[model samples]
Target: MNHLISRAGLGILVAVAVVAGAWARSGSGSVTAQAVLTGLLLGGVYALVAMGLTLIFGVLDIVNFAHGAFMTLGMYATALLATGAGLNPYLSLLVSVPLLFGLGYAVQRHLVSRTMGGSLAAQLLLTLGIAMLLENALLLAFSGDTRTVAVSFDTPLRVLGAVADLSRVLAFAGAMGLAGAVWLLLTRTRLGTAIRAVAANPEGASLVGLDVRRLHALTFAAGTACAGAAGTLVTPLVTVEPTAGELFNIIGFVVVVLGGLGSVPGAVAGGLIVGLTEQLGGIYLPGQSPLLAVFAVFVLVLLWRPQGLFGRPA
Candidate 1:
């Protein structure tokens, strides 16, 4: 009961802050619209990445530090297909998604499965090591050169009085669709029900004839596949390099926490909030780093609800 009240209080506070901020910047209507649109598009991608992280954490209780690395691999895969075979960047998704899914399933089955029920430190270290290995391997193979997929359709279009590239629009649309699909899979499918059962209580799930270990692997694979798809989605918007996923790693964690670990809807809302905060912060602060606002909001939310906005009280 107290948790509910506290959450409501925080929500009200946040709402007030947003209204106040908007009122303060009411004069810059066009600029505000541009920021809102841009933030929303960027937030969609962030939500895609966070959805995977949240799923793994919610179900397997694994803090997958290597998620961004998986995304990096996806970016490289898409770029390679585009540059080498002259495939359209979007067409590369058919290959990259499955490739990532297989890689994730293999890694979970052979590697990550060993550390189940172990120390949190062990899991973190193992995932961190995985991240490092993938990054270094990519560095060796690609020599740290930034790569891009050539696309001729990236023409700028006016959207609600704000200009945006076609690629960004498409990326945003694709991400939202994928995120929704994941949501439906979780809420409507047998696999999702089994996964949720395991997440709720592994021992009970096992007693009920469910294969917990297999479910864990499946969840992890799904999570990694999300990272990979996100990477492919953003290939046209960002540079592909060995360390490209590093920043996203940070942002993913932030979004995961902001949305409440394990809550899909929370992740989506948090992504939009973080995205808007970043864009509007630039406009309001003028010279400060946009991330400063994101962190500020993060800290405030943590202070108010450490379990995250959508997370239940411990």
Candidate 2:
């Protein structure tokens, strides 16, 4: 794992150097700076999404195909509160987070928990069904129209000669702050200790008098809450559509695999790397979609480190 992380780190540095060199040769230092800045900010959002995902997988050992659906639900929840109730989008987190958390907990306790210790295929199908159902339900309710929350701080901020949207900066800061808080919860709190214990050894946790099922439900709910927070944060930056969660779903998976299947900090690192790859790719591959570049990096990383950059080697 250490060696893999080192190699990954080296690859990131090399990637940065190459992108910087390309931009320099093109005499577009400002454009390069802007891409890097944009990528980092975008990466913060990705980290927030992926952190929830990693946490769920780490504890529940289930790949939540419906995770993105939860995010879309969050987006709509925030949108409804902001537009209907005249609440600030950021302030909507209070409602969105708890609502999603309760939904997640109920889903896990009533539905997902049944599939535990069963076939992996069963879990996949269940989550995929949930994803489809939630998405279609959203479409029925809101139609395909794109909704957005307008914010006052849409102005651009200058950072080191590069321009960034103020909203994006705020979202980035919020993402980092939330991620840090989650990290602290995991490392410091008793519930966190129980969650970690369950992740490490469910039988052992059970033997230690831990209510494993409750912890699983709580962890899953916590993960969904993170998704809700992310949805709220990005409400001002992106269009809110039923299908809006699809892109985040794809990126979240990429981040999960790249960072390691179950590492929280790894998700953050992977998100930044993916973000950089996206922005730099736009500069280097002028005609291709930036996501294409992200996939290329994903492929290379998978080839070299299937356990992920931060995952323990088997």
Residue pairs whose backbone atoms clash in candidate 2: none
lDDT of 2 at 209: 100
Give the per-residue lDDT digits (tens) of candidate 2, residues 149-252: 98865898999889998889999999999999999999999999999999999999999999999999999999999998999999999999998888887899
**CA-lDDT, candidates in order:** 0.89, 0.90
Best of the candidates, TM-score: 2
Question: How many pairs collide in each candidate, listed in order?
Answer: 0, 0
lDDT by residue for model 1 over 223-266, one digit each (tens)?
88899999999999998999999888888888999999999988
By summed lDDT, the worst window of 10 consecutive residues in model 1 runs over: 15-24
Superposed model 1: Cα runs more than 4 Å off: 1-27
Q: Flag regions of model 2 displaced more than 4 Å.
A: 1-12
Clashing pairs in 1: none
